[model samples]
Target chain A: MMGAPLLEVRNLESFYGPIMAIRGVSLSVEEGQIVTVLGANGAGKSTLLKTISGIMDPEKGSVSFDGAEIQGEEPHRIVSRGIVHVPEGREVFPLLSVDENLSLGAYTRKDRSAIERDREMVFEYFPILAERRHQEAGTLSGGQQQMLAIGRGLMLRPRIMLLDEPSLGLSPLLVQEIFAILGRLNREEGVTMMLVEQNARIALELAHVGYVMEIGRIVMNGDADRLMQSEDIKAFYLGQQEAGQRSEKRWKRKKTWR
Target chain B: MDGVQLLVSGLANGCVYGLIALGFVLIYKATEAVNFAQGDFMMLGAFVTLGLTNAEYLHLPFWIAAPLAILIMAFFGYLLDLLILRHLFGQSQTAVVILTIALGFVIRFVAGVIWGHEPQTLESPLAFGDVSLGGVVLGMADVAVIVVTVLLTWSLYQFFQRTKLGLAMQAASQNQMAAYFMGIPVKRVQGLIWGLSGATAAVAGILFASKGAIDPNAGLLGIKAFAAAVIGGFGSLPGALAGGLIVGVIEPFAARYLAAGYSQIAPYALLLAVLVFRPHGLFSQVRTKKV
Candidate 1:
């Protein structure tokens, strides 16, 4: 359902030492769509995000974004090329002030006026950041840091944003708010997203396309709605399909091991 | 000499200590590791000055030789960062200390081998005469030391606060990974910091050597610089200066007012007191770990 792929990974294999984290996995995201990678613990979701963003090199295949090869570029170079990655566990620089953290996101950009405009856009998306601009980031709560991380990523104004575990350690309310924000960014800003989440149900719900990665391999893939309704997805994650239920038993199962 | 005269001398010495302390802090902030080689870097600056000012090589005017020496030291600073310091990165802090300790021995041996172990002094514009105010004579070198240290520190403070590169350095010091993500050449900024530290150490070395005969073994003062850093708060530039001044002011006063043996213990006592009370340092932000 597309005009060639906006981002494509064909026969990609990423490794960590001798242990293979992503084995011959291929996926694609179109120009303006949300694609979520849903999986359980020990899955290759984080590696997939990192490898695409050029933080970790894939041992065996190509990562082509917008039909351009970006397999061997450095992470900063990848970011400068407009592929921003918000790493796992919200790796916001804790010692820096909120404003410093935001300013650093536009580190590679030299257009002062445009950078200032983007800064305002990010502040609008997360007003708490403006209020706590001078405050050191480490002191903020988990939810606020997650918001800051996203805000920092938004500072790049990237066409395709790769977010890794944006909801980890967040409260239920905060998680919902985060998902809502992601949905809005996709719908309103037309920013394509590659979201990796352990929360399989919500990830699939917000996504147009979903892939299930199990033990370093792409085990299942299809339309998000269909995957959400699949027996295997329900069996492992949803437990029982309640039409209005978002708080499923699978979260309790994932929390212990995540 | 009266109390005021003794106080003036102590203040000058304190300023030297503070400058060296700043050098220590500069390297530590960039690397998050101690460079025991810092004192040797300072000694090398003085030796370079001697070479330039010697009636042989660049035997140019004082104005030219002093700056040429500092620049040469800065170049070597960059070289050292490229060759030695860069290789030790990502290693444990303890390993960094050991590496630099080894570097210090090499620097001292090489400097002694190449330049000889003879004690020397760089030429100075100031004479032995002192400025007498209300019958207390303050040596010209003492006044020069204090005035120069204050002016240099103030200018450096302005530079760090105003310049974009300086801001980048501060960002890298706080969190290198975040800075790299921002498109900053974090490693290059680190090399620049090391170069700046080398330049600062040269200034401190030149000023300190003015008060005495310079020898290659003089780098042993790095221990004192380390104490100053610990006392001031490891990463705080202001703290390094204040710590240096505290140590400088303590030594002579203790020798004169208290027991001479107690002078050696004074700075350590202050450092211990500060460590036990505010470990993050007087000016440093308390780092919070995610764990």
Candidate 2:
């Protein structure tokens, strides 16, 4: 709150061919804070994360990481600068062994002993990964693959982690398990995170600040607790229906702020 | 004694085929683009070595020329990808196949212009030497071929299994997007793979030249090597070598025991039989890409 945020994106615009996927969106993640971006499908939450992580270049505006302009840099270079993007669908190398996948996360680092130690640390975080260290990652169940993906990200020792839908396709129980570790990572390691999720309830509970996006734009932003109490969020996201309010009419009702 | 002699010669010949097949598999594994011109790359490597060692040219020793030739071919492969193949990304696989096929024609024509069409022998320390073991005799050139192939395959296996860069290459080959996310320079790693393949092709060409004679058309032998890769399972490294050995050993036996023309058709017949029975290959490890 006192100085520049660890990662700041200002008036960013990105296009998929002729269509704009993220239009003039701006957000910031302060060092050591867990920020969550909640949005429905097609709201461009993943696009925003991809742009910031340098996987997709922004057509306009700037991304500054630790006060340095990093727009248009290669994704690998962005990772070396201490930002790691855990892409959606848990894109773990399916053919590689779990250990090989973890070692690759430290590809940018040259410290031999530290890399070995961090590999151990990742195993500690996801003990299941250690038991299946020699197994091909593709053979793991969806939940375990997600754990391996997060463990792979931690191997980078990243200052800021951009995680896209860590809970996607996961059962409610597995989601709780993963989010708990994420909260611990934020608190214990001070690893700043910008998580994009559709499950608003759990995301808000873990995040310090939350942003609500709709159709490539940030429609609302506030403290997580206050946003959790907002009537609109309760009505639409938290599945709380007002008395006599039809489910079909919910989409037709305009937000108070708009 | 005759059978032992035939087997040794067949194995040495097969080793060359295996090395060229390794080039094919390495490039295919990395980029998913089949370099039909891989044989042409071998041809170029031989010509380059010839230019450096032949009396009318640089006239350098074979020992010096071979390594220099390998380095030059590696650099050429790297540049070819950087300048041309890199631009073809996102294009259809068929387009790449056609382009490489055309590239093969270009390489052969250019090589013909430089080295001419006549068969030429490569001078080497192993040319006339022979080692006799019991009742059978082996040409030093043949022994050298088998030894180099074994050593090269072992080192390549160690590299992919143990080295960081090698692991990174494997990771990139599996999933480019994930590899990029891991801070791997995927494009650069791909270029390095091409360079490695080129170097491998040079070794094949040098060994082939050492055994007998090389003409511009000698590269057509890559077709046999391609058959070997398919038999081995295009995705498996050792399979390629094993496939090569099968093809190499079959040809001589077919010539001696069967008809004269049967030797030429033996490898393709085996290729057909493998395709019919085990379409994925003898040691297939290929998996459909995860969405």
Candidate 3:
């Protein structure tokens, strides 16, 4: 949509021990856009984010953030380059208080005044965290932990945030509220995001562009609204197709996409 | 001896064990590796100071030689991590523990080659005869030992609580991967913790050497310190001091109250009892990692 995408990937491959986890995967996120990768379990969505964030190395391919190649840099180096990854499990330090966890999020920054302002802004988004500022992170409820995770990521003032499964294990009401906040952040703060999720309906609703991943490769990509309307997606992912409503004898499944 | 005299002596010895156990906890906290070589590190520090202060050698005064020895040990700790422990990262925890045991042997052998096999006394300026308080008598060396232990422990507590670098070290020790994600230099922090542990071990060695005779086997005392760490809840500093006091007091009282031979096993018996009641140690809480 612009001169260049804010984040770009090409032919990425990664492995876990002896198993091939991600094979020749590629995707991109343009500035100010919310892109979502939707897939079932074992589809390598987390692997893709981990590779881009430099938590794991790719056997082949390049990852360029903004304009620089950062395929094999250390995770800390990647964060300083303005790409923050909120990992799948909401890994806030269990023993550390909420305040200390947020302070640690700004570990890489030297702009003290801006860090303070950002902390205030994070508290604005998650008022519960502010109320429990001195409480240990482990004691917070699941929804609160997810909020703390995002708030910690925000402390970095990242240009692009890679959030993995923000809606996982959350109640529908909580999921709706979290996605609404994410949408507001994108529209108001201009923060680009690449979200990975298995909850297809909510993910598609929040994303501008959606990619369907099966196994380790992208099988489908299009506007999120169009993908949501696709018959195959409606049948398989959205659970909208009932047995009597289908005209065909059996639904066809695509194996590959070019 | 009166009960008061026995208590003071027990506490003085406990302070020495506490100092050594603190070293064990420091290295273990940062790397999650139980360093069997910690006692050897203390022995090396004592040997270095002895070599420097010996009348035949440099003959440096205790004040100068002790600090110099600690500084060198600190450097040695950094190199030990850089040259050996750094490469062991991501390796099996059991393998690293065995390697540390090997490292202990290497240090002991090296010290034997350099300083001979005989035991010798370390001279201290404060070793002036015993000071008697009413009916109880206390050695000036014992008083010196207690004072140094309290001061060192307080300073280390302040360092961890007040400084950014120290907080980073604590954060790294708690969750290394999360700390790295937060942009902390985890590897460098591990190296610094090892250096700090080495410096603390050196202080323990100097204090032990000043109290009595020390030989190459002085490092064997590290095993007892390891027990102290476990009894105190391995990661907690104040627990280490408490564990040491418990162990130190138990041993001497065992000899006086129980059979003369019971003293040697008294500390271990207490360790076993604590383990039976609180397997995580007296001070540690059960931490369950989120899935």
lDDT of each: 0.83, 0.90, 0.87
DockQ of 2: 0.66
Clash number for every model?
0, 0, 0
Write out the backbone clash pairs for model 3.
none
Among all windows of ten consecutive residues in candidate 1 chain A, which has the lowest summed lDDT? A249-258
Error of 3 at A180 (Å): 2.4
Q: What is the interface RMSD of each candidate, in Å?
A: 2.2, 1.8, 1.5
Encode model 1's per-residue lDDT on A118-219: one tens digit a residue: 889888778888999999889888888888889888888887889888888888888999899889888888889999988887888899999988888787
Docking quality of model 3: it rates as: medium
RMSD of each: 3.8, 2.0, 2.1
lDDT of 2 by residue, A48-145 (tens): 98888888899999999999999999988999998999989889888889999999999999998998999998888889999999999998888899
Model 2: per-residue Cα lDDT over B1-291, one tens digit each = 999989999999899899988898888888888999999899889889988998988999888999999999999999988998989988997888898899888988998898889999887666788999996898989999999999999999999989999999999888889999999989999999999999999988888888988888888999999999999999888999999998899888999998887878989999999999999889878665343
Q: Model 3: per-residue lDDT, tens digit, A43-152?
A: 99998998898888999989998899999998889999988888787778777789888888888898989999999998888899999999988888888889988989
Which candidate leads in lDDT? 2
Worst lDDT window (10 residues) for model 1 chain B? Answer: B120-129
Query: Chain B TM per candidate, please?
Result: 0.94, 0.97, 0.97
In candidate 1, the second chain superimposes onto the true chain B with a TM-score of 0.94
Candidate 1 vs 3: which has more TM-score: 3
Largest TM-score belongs to which candidate?
2
